[model samples]
Target: MAGKHLLVLIVCLILLNLSATFASKQNTTTLNEATACIDGASITLTFGFYINSCPEAEPIIFSWIEKAVSDDPRMAASLLRLHFHDCFVNASSFQLGCDASVLLDDTPNFVGEKTAAPNANSLRGFEVIDAIKADLEYVCPQTVSCADILAIAARDSVVLSGGPGWEVEMGRRDSLSASKTAANNNIPGPNSDVATLLSKFQNVGLSLQELVALSGAHTMGKARCSSFSARINSSSSIISNSPDVNLEYLQSLQQLCSQSDANTTLADLDHITPTTFDNQYYVNLVSGEGLLGSDQALLTGNEETRRIIECYAGDVEAFYEDFKMAMLKMGRLQQVNGGDGEVRRNCRAVNQLGS
Candidate 1:
């Protein structure tokens, strides 16, 4: 932890000269001054929702996350993606927004979100959430919801990865069901164009600027070879008509993916700082080194998205502020009002009746 703090200090110092403030609704440093948050179901979420029922909720979740990320730096990115996946997919009537449906395991009756195109073979770190949920159930059975665990874990993951911290509004309930179909159709894909990306964000109440800011999460993770294969594959037409990318950079990606095991090979999203949670993703995009077509689309997209991307690339502080705001807003997303939501004793399965 001390090492990460020192690293953050060095990064901030190096980039402070390039700082410029973007529009922000509240000061991250002053949590009390932050605006109130409510879920899509119209349930008011508050800080410290488990202060009395589960006083150790946050501490326990943080301890497990800190350990997991320490043991595997990639775990931080995985957990962060969990919250992101959990927060979206509301396009159809299923609307499993931020309800932890992504954590569900398939049963004999229904398929879960795990096998969705966006989630299967891509998502990880579920065991960590299971372990934390087991401990929370032992400490205060059914007091802390899996949805809340995901939100808090996402925040702590960013903090541990040397990014800004924000208060995660709590009191979210776990969804009783999961939707593989919705996940397939709703979650944004790496191949999506800028218009589809912005439309999806708006469908869920996020702004175009928030889409740019939230995409900054790409800084900490990696992408599969399939994710950007079209961007540089000489045989594919996405290359000739694609946005300008550095020649050497495109060649390197092509070489990496051309390997015999290309299907399973992974490429760092931010080649400069693969594991750090910083605005370097934007910086890389500015250089035309963004890993996904969806990412480079931001640069080639309309003026507003491009302007915000450049703002973040030049201003780390501004990026951090907007990211916190966006994450907070995303954490509050909920699709259902009341039916079939519960504080599950197990994250992967709903409680049996009369247990």
Candidate 2:
């Protein structure tokens, strides 16, 4: 009986060892899978991504952009807006990543974002991108990605237009697809109310403070009369009823945006410093001189947003600092890095072979 009990005990010990070994292997596999997923997602793109591969890429881009902006100061704002529009599309799960999808022309199977309602005839700066890309291709072949070019151009635009500059994280790759439906749905409209604008920004993980700071990009751009004529012409508009709007400003806008020429006439978004990038946009908002209804909505809608507008109006340095950080954060959204995407040969079209 004692011998039988010893045999049973040995058998139980063997089974226990087997179970332990199996659990150990299972835990290791789970850990490895988790680590790989984390590594894939956390692709930290640095500013020196092209230091070895294409040393002169940034300098070449800077030279062309500097010349372009020197000839046309408005090109800075256009370039900056191009970056914003390109990065703002729905990039999370849909792979509409910040891959210069907005620059793609419409193909039969895929409709590009360039002609979306908010972007049609409004978004400029494509020629500037083409010029820079052509120069880069000559110098570095396919070493640089259009996504990186757009990001760098945006940084250069702010510096040229007298705003603070930040180091743009590089190493992003271009997407193989473009989505007009995503662009039309994602890009905020000029007539969007404060709630809608907040929702759009929040959808992309941006905060209200960031939204207010980024909106200050309007300091250097011009809005067509069609963008805001309804505010002045429509009797029920908040601008018509609010005493905050300067009467003189209203009269000037009315004169500029007559019904017949609403589409052609353009007005400076920041009348105080029309051609410069500064905190004057926030100042304009404080005084009810904001160019678009969406611009004014910052002050009129939420207390926190209004407070931010007031703070930026009073503190230029704060605005610049916040704007720099906000832009960097926006540029980092859903970026394609590592071997996840490819560097396109043409910014306007996807790489045909393997992107």
Candidate 3:
């Protein structure tokens, strides 16, 4: 009983600190340096597999994450997104699971996913991963895989953002090639309807609940206006016809995006508690304030989605648990048919094209 009470006290203290740090913009120290993950017993290919081969691997990567996130709090979300974009790609020619193919650079012989419509100028944190891999190679050369680094970094990001964590499966290999074609087709756009979102998730072995839970990630980052301008623009059919938006909020969004660079303008996904990884995203959806049409679609998708949203909005712990589980499942995905797999000394290229 005392142990449980102690844990509760610790959590409360962490939340209090996070709120203070965020409430002050002058404090460039955005994301917290410490991790809040309370659990790590979920999945493991061989528990502590790196303990023997490269004891310094996880620590090295984690140290870099701490420094990077401390300097730029938004980095935590970018690392999490790096893993997400890495895992969702597919190729008609070859299989490319969570192999870190998304990190590859384009060559004369073939293309990569960076330039895909969903990814072009959208992804970040590549340099950070490069630094982590460089340090890993220095301590234990060629022992850690880029794919595994992404998974671990993602878990750490969530933990630092006041979310739950799970043991990431290690030993997953990296991809030898990336697929621009697959990335274009596989990743869903922000304007996707609930049906399209459901189809996309289902194609990757996820369900509707996972869909609702994973969308909760929106609780952190900001979405570019280009991604959802149609939903709030008066000239767009979605705004003119849809009944799922808050009029006052929509007006603010319109004014914000009215700039000539409106397409690149940014807006928070969750207006309430946008920095913390809480259940506020679900709460926003229930109130029709979800930034992206795809996100708001969950509320009106059907009874099941609506029920899941309401449940998460009412219970934060449940949202964390479900989000963690869904992320684990997403980390396991390899959408491409038969892509290459090997640990490259440099994450940007496969073994053959060593930098």
Clashes of each: 0, 0, 10
Model 1 alpha-carbon miss at residue 318, Å: 0.8
The window of 10 residues in a row where model 2 has the poorest summed lDDT is: 31-40
Model 2: per-residue Cα lDDT over 1-355, one tens digit each: 8974575455435334543653454356532231111111233577567868986676666666778899999889899999899988963364645678888888876888888987888888888888888878887988899999998898778877877665566888887677888898899999888899989988887777778888999999888998887677757457567866776777788887875578878899888887798899998988889888888878888888898888889988777767766776787778766666678888888778323
Candidate 1 has an lDDT of 0.80
TM-score of 2: 0.85
After the best TM-score superposition of candidate 3, give how far the Cα of residue 181 lies from its true spot, in angstroms: 0.5
Cα lDDT of all candidates, in order? 0.80, 0.78, 0.76
User: Over the stretch 1-355, how does candidate 1's per-residue lDDT look in tens digits?
Assistant: 8985575455444323222221122333443322222122233587657868987777778778888999999889999999998888652354458888898899876688899999999999999999999999898998998889999899889989999776667878777788788888778999899999988888888878778888999999888898777787787665666555676888899888988576699999889988899999999989888899899889886788888888888989878877887887888775444655788888888787313
TM-score of each: 0.86, 0.85, 0.84
| Best candidate according to lDDT | 1
RMSD per model, one decimal: 6.6, 18.2, 9.4
Judged by whole-model lDDT over C-alpha atoms, candidate 2 comes out at 0.78
| Model 3 Cα lDDT, one tens digit per residue, 1-355 | 8974575455545434543543342144211211112122234344355868986666666667777888887778788888888888874345555788889999886799999998898888999999999988887888888988998888777777777756555777787778899898888889898899899888877788788878888888888888987778788765566676677888888888886586578888878776677899988888879888888878876788898889888988777767765777787675322234667799998877875
Winner on lDDT between 1 and 2 is 1
lDDT score at residue 299, model 1, on the 0-100 scale: 88
